[model samples]
Target: MMYKSTLSVKKEIALHLLFWVIWVYFTLAVVDANGIHFAEMDLFSSTWCITYVVTFYVNYLFVLPKVFHPFKWIKAIAGLVVIFLFFAALRYFLEQFLTVQLFNVQNYNPGTGILYYIYDNTFYAARPIILSSAFWLIVLLVRLLDYNKYIIEEQKNTEIKFLKAQINPHFVFNTLNNIYSMVHFQSPNALPAIEKLSSIMRFTTYEAPRNFIRLGEELNYIHAYLELEELRHYDKSFVSWETTVQSDNHEIPPYLLSPLVENALKHGSYTAEIPIIIRLSCNDQQLDFEVINRIGNQKKDKLGGIGIDNLKNRLEILYPEKHTLQTTEQEGLFSAHLVIYFQ
Candidate 1:
């Protein structure tokens, strides 16, 4: 904790130094553009530079926070107005005194009226205030951007945790049901079913907790799941799987394809003579997947399924605008197509 705090302090100091260096350079350039020699302008430049620095910190550290709070608007505005007037008057007198006393420069007119003197001083002071306000706005913008980035990172972490929690429970429940059915029938595939379930459980418990996994690894998990489902259905159902993955090196969010496949198997019509078809194609840029199954006479509630809703939520969080998912039912057939674009 101490190390982190020390590092943060160092970073803040470095950033402040960098900003001041740039500010000085810009001020020098502007003075040079006005054909003013450095020796003659040194006092003028230094005075306003210090004035701007003071103004920026005063607004940034104190006034800005109050301004940001909507409930404190009246107090904040009143305070800001008072500060602005005070700084404006202070800058005018400071510059006048430094120029006249330190450099023996004289521009004051003793005969001038108080109102005219005040007006002239206020006009000169406005320049420093304007420059300070510009720097303060930049500081606010940088802080806002940093805050937005932190928020996005926190939201992403929360979404991944939620998805992982949902996936494990749903997957385990479905796989256990399949295993129970196999045991109840006293089928010869019961042992192999247990092995498949074990492998899937391992993947979900370990691999799926990660942010990303190789596409090939995910496909292998899907294969294991399909095999387990096949054992449960026995010879009563048929599945046709096809793939055209151009590379196994591609990475995707873990368990991304499992829910779609699970939904197909759970809701597909088993009595149909036509086999359920699942197709997956991938290239360097994108992945395309489709699952088509025969619909039974009893209409499957596709929209009402928790698995599908969970899948949609995960897709929205992970892929956002980078992927498309569509489901259609026509002529006793239900089809789900998904396309994901890689960055």
Candidate 2:
């Protein structure tokens, strides 16, 4: 917390210095163009620059916050008017003192009486207020943009958490049902199935909680799930798993690809002669995952179920335009193809 606060203070100081440097450069250039002596121009510009800086910081630190509060609109407006008038008077007096008293600038017009003096210098006094208001507007704009960025990040995190909660319960229920079926049949594979279930539970409970995990970790989880399914069906089901991963270092959203494999096994026809084929390939730039299964007489829903719908929502949130998902049903074959592009 302290480190971040110190960094913020440093940035503010740097920005303040940059603004003042630019102001000084422009002020000197205008004075020089007016054919004033270099020394006189320097002194004159420096004096008014202080007043401008003071006006800006005072309004920015105090008055601007009050002005932004909708409930204090009337009081804030009155305060702003008072602040402008006070600074304007100060600027007028300082200019007069520096030019007439210090520099004795010739042909300096001193208007008749206090009324004429106020009238003539009123616009000059308002210069600082106008410049300060412009600066305040810019500061407010930057702060608003930062606030919007923060809101978007928070929303994304909330959505991810909700999705994970939904996935875990659904996954556990399905896996438990598969295990129960194997035990009822008095299959010898039941013990090995329980061991694979332990590994799946560990991955889902631990790794799935994170926003992102290595592509390899997700693939390992998928392999474990497929192994568990193999024990349940035995020789009744056949799965052809092919993978060509160029690198395991790539990062992806956790449990992203598992749903596609799960959907394929759940809906696939074990009675069919052909085996269910699950193909996954990845290179440096893109990942291609395709799952094909025989439909038999069962009607396949192209839009998919809760798990697939959840997967789509997560893909949209995490990958957006970077991913493509296509489902095609040709003859009795149902295929789901997904391609994800790395940034």
Candidate 3:
């Protein structure tokens, strides 16, 4: 922390030096353009620049922050009045007294009234006052924007972690229930189902926690889950899945696809006549997935199993406007279609 603070201070000092350097160059340019002799203008411009720098820092360091708070406009006005007077008095002392005594030149007429001198210098003081305040305001705005971006990024990561955490337990609970049913029936498929469960659990434990995984790894998990489900139902032909991929190296959010499969198996009806239909096709541009199933005799909530709301939230966070998920029920069939465009 101390190192960072030192670095920040160094940068700030560099910026201030840069500002003054540029100001000096421009002031000299203007003075020379006015046809003043170079040697005399050096003395005048040096005094003027020094006075402007003092005015700039006085308001910056002492006045603006204290007076510029919310509900302090009256204080701000008073503060500016104080700065204007200070600037005029300081300039009068240096230019009228010191410069005249040393170089025999005075910026103002020797006999000018005090009020007119103060009023006339207002025009000069306005530049340093306004520019310095503007610089402060710009720095404050940029800091605020950086802090806001940091806060947003933190919130996004926290929510995604929460949503990812929810998926694993939900999937494990349903899979365990299927295994329990097979074990209670003393079915021959119980041992194979348990083995399949081990593979699924390994993926969920180790791989699923990552933000992304190889698309082929997720597909392998899906294949294991389907085989386990087939053993439970005692029918390999009742579920159909077709996948065409341009490459297996594409990355995907872990467990993103499994919920659709789980939802179908949990709520869908299966028979030789009308099997559950799952289709997926992926290319460099996008991924397309669809699942269709026959409606069963059992009542099912469209948004129930695997929680469509949860799925929708994850999709919105991960893909934003780049993906679409649509579901519809018509003519004894329920279907879900998902399309995700890669960035």
Which has the greatest lDDT? 3
lDDT of candidate 2? Answer: 0.76
> What TM-score against the true fold does each predicted structure earn?
0.79, 0.81, 0.82
Off by over 4 Å in 3: 1-18, 30-44, 67-75, 85-114, 304-306
Q: State each model's CA lDDT, in order.
A: 0.75, 0.76, 0.82
Arranged by TM-score, best first: 3, 2, 1
Clashing pairs in 2: none
Q: Residues 97-145, candidate 2: write the lDDT tens digits.
A: 6566777752236664767665665665566666666776776677667
Candidate 3, TM-score vs. the true structure? Answer: 0.82
lDDT of 3 by residue, 1-343 (tens): 1112222556767878888777666655445566743344666677787889899999888888778665387898898999998898889889899998898998888799988988788899999999888877766676667667766767777787887788888878878988999999999999999999999989988998888998899889988988888898898888787889989788998877777877787788887679989899999999998889887777662646544567788899889999999889999888988899996
Q: Give me the displacement of residue 53 in model 1, in angstroms.
A: 5.1
Per TM-score, the best of the predicted structures is 3
Worst 10 residues of 1 by lDDT: 1-10
The C-alpha RMSD in Å for every predicted model, in order, reads 4.5, 4.4, 4.1
Q: lDDT score, residue 119, model 3?
A: 79
